[model samples]
Target: MTTTKALLIGQRRRLALTMVGGFAGVVALALAVAVVADLADIRTATALTDRLVPLLVFYAPAPIAAAGAYARCGGPACLTVGVVPALVFATLVVAGTVFGVPGVGGGDAPLGGVTMSFALVGLSGAFVGYCAGVTAALLADLAGFGGDGGDGGDGETDAAE
Candidate 1:
């Protein structure tokens, strides 16, 4: 059986696909949440907005980045795939603070607090992503996946390699 090795920079197509897929995954989730947030008729014990704000601001980006890092297993795609989702959520937080979004802007909190919170969230997302990437790389190494030195993990090594 022939083996295929994955490369970070040398292989263009697979890298592009993963990058696009990661970005799309983040966008799709944001759109889904937006659709849910826009509905006025839905009733729940807790306002969906109250629950979903945390989903958007904290839960979503970190996991997505982590998953991307895990999937990439050691590629730059880890950062590219992870950071977009993080920034998307971060942007929403900043906008919510500036525009007074209910359940999001924390109207009683000082603007400085909002800034610090968003900054923390954003940095945490990226840092967590990096850590995940590191973990994935270590895991790949343990699995004997990285000794090949051509690719990280997203599957399909370059034919030329």
Candidate 2:
């Protein structure tokens, strides 16, 4: 009963499910921390520092989770798995910046700065996630987790002949 359509759907579903962890875990945590700090009127010694904390939190674990997800998939498909979630988060950040989310500390910066900062946050998250995914793939390859036993050597061998 298995069809190509069903298989593709299942694959897409798996990617979506994996991405939810990155979105819910890392991005949501960052948003919540920003909200809590705002509600509590918490301010660090420097306004810039206070504003940057959320961005830092948002980007920190994103790549790590992405790497883990890529490792789970065991191949190049992991790039999409890692990058998609990070891009999703970045899109949210850009939208929030454009719309002026209150108490996010993004509103006070100059338009250019705000745009640059949020854009960079998202872009950097994606870049880091991509790098992490590559590293994970390499490690997996080295460990012989998913391979035909060539292990990066020439295809020819005495046993094969």
Candidate 3:
């Protein structure tokens, strides 16, 4: 396959893994927090704004995991792989938030004031996650963690080497 096509395929796989892992993590975390908060009598579990904190927190890890997976592929395009997951997450979150909240607009427009604000918040969270994931991948590349540098774990060598 062409290089661009291969990269796209790799990115898609990374995104899928990120979504699956992220969803599982978020569910598990929500349940755990619910149990603990119930025992502790903390009302933040049901509070509207407070719940956003956990949502952002739980969502952060998925992109990091995706970046790690992408870094394993070991190429100059690792950052691109990291970014794909973040964009995917952001898009989904923004679309969901905007649609879930009902608003009456004169036109057929999708978002209203409150919903737009929520979408922005979700987008910011996704941006942070994306930056984090890309940073992790870049750091790994610099540290020679997953590059095709003949580390011998994969029993392969770069042709240029």
Candidate 4:
């Protein structure tokens, strides 16, 4: 293949992977939020919405990374990007708690009180789901289970090898 053709092929692959990863991340985040609500006994829509605050807050950065992952690399890289933010947030919360920092709780106090803990856990769970989804998508892509791989057919492996 010519240099330009190769470059374009690589770019297309990266974009496709990133898009898949981003979509998976979004779905995973939604499911995770639902699960959190269910686990917290939020049966009603209003109750679920109320409980979803922290989760939504935590996932604010997820889309940016997901988009980037879909644009440059495959799901594995996308997951790494998504996970780093979650880990950082978790670490900060833990560190602050250890140092007796107040109001981290999402209130007048350092830890934000009970709400803070709930939010933290929700965020963490969403992040975990996002990472899992990205990894799963990447694996599926690599295994030729899903996604377009220039094969022009669904679920058909290219026998170019």
Sorted on TM-score, best first, the list reads: 1, 2, 3, 4
Candidate with the greatest lDDT versus the true structure: 1
lDDT of 4 at 147: 47
Instruction: List model 1 lDDT by residue over 33-149, tens digit each.
Output: 663555444456136656755565555555555554444433454445434544555456567668766555445656555555654764577557657655765577678864444
Query: What Cα-based lDDT does every candidate model obtain?
Result: 0.52, 0.46, 0.43, 0.44
Better of 2 and 3 by TM-score: 2
Q: Taking the tens digit of each residue's C-alpha lDDT, what string does model 4 give over 42-114?
A: 6785365555534444564355434433232333443444344344444445654576555322234444344
Kindly report which residue stretches of model 3 are placed more than 4 angstroms away from their true locations once superposed. 1-111, 147-161
lDDT of 2 by residue, 40-116 (tens): 66775245446655555455445654544443432333333334434444555566667676654334546555545
Predicted candidate 3 versus true structure: per-residue lDDT over 53-122, tens digit per residue: 3454445444543454343432223333323333444444465456662221123444344345444554
Positional deviation of residue 138's Cα in model 2 after best superposition, in angstroms = 3.3
RMSD of 3: 8.8
Q: Which one wins by lDDT: 2 or 4?
A: 2
lDDT, model 1: 0.52
lDDT of 1 at 96: 68
Kindly report which residue pairs in candidate 1 clash with one another.
Answer: 5-157, 6-151, 7-151
> Model 4 reaches what TM-score against the true structure?
0.30
Better of 1 and 3 by lDDT: 1
What TM-score does each of the candidates earn?
Answer: 0.48, 0.43, 0.37, 0.30
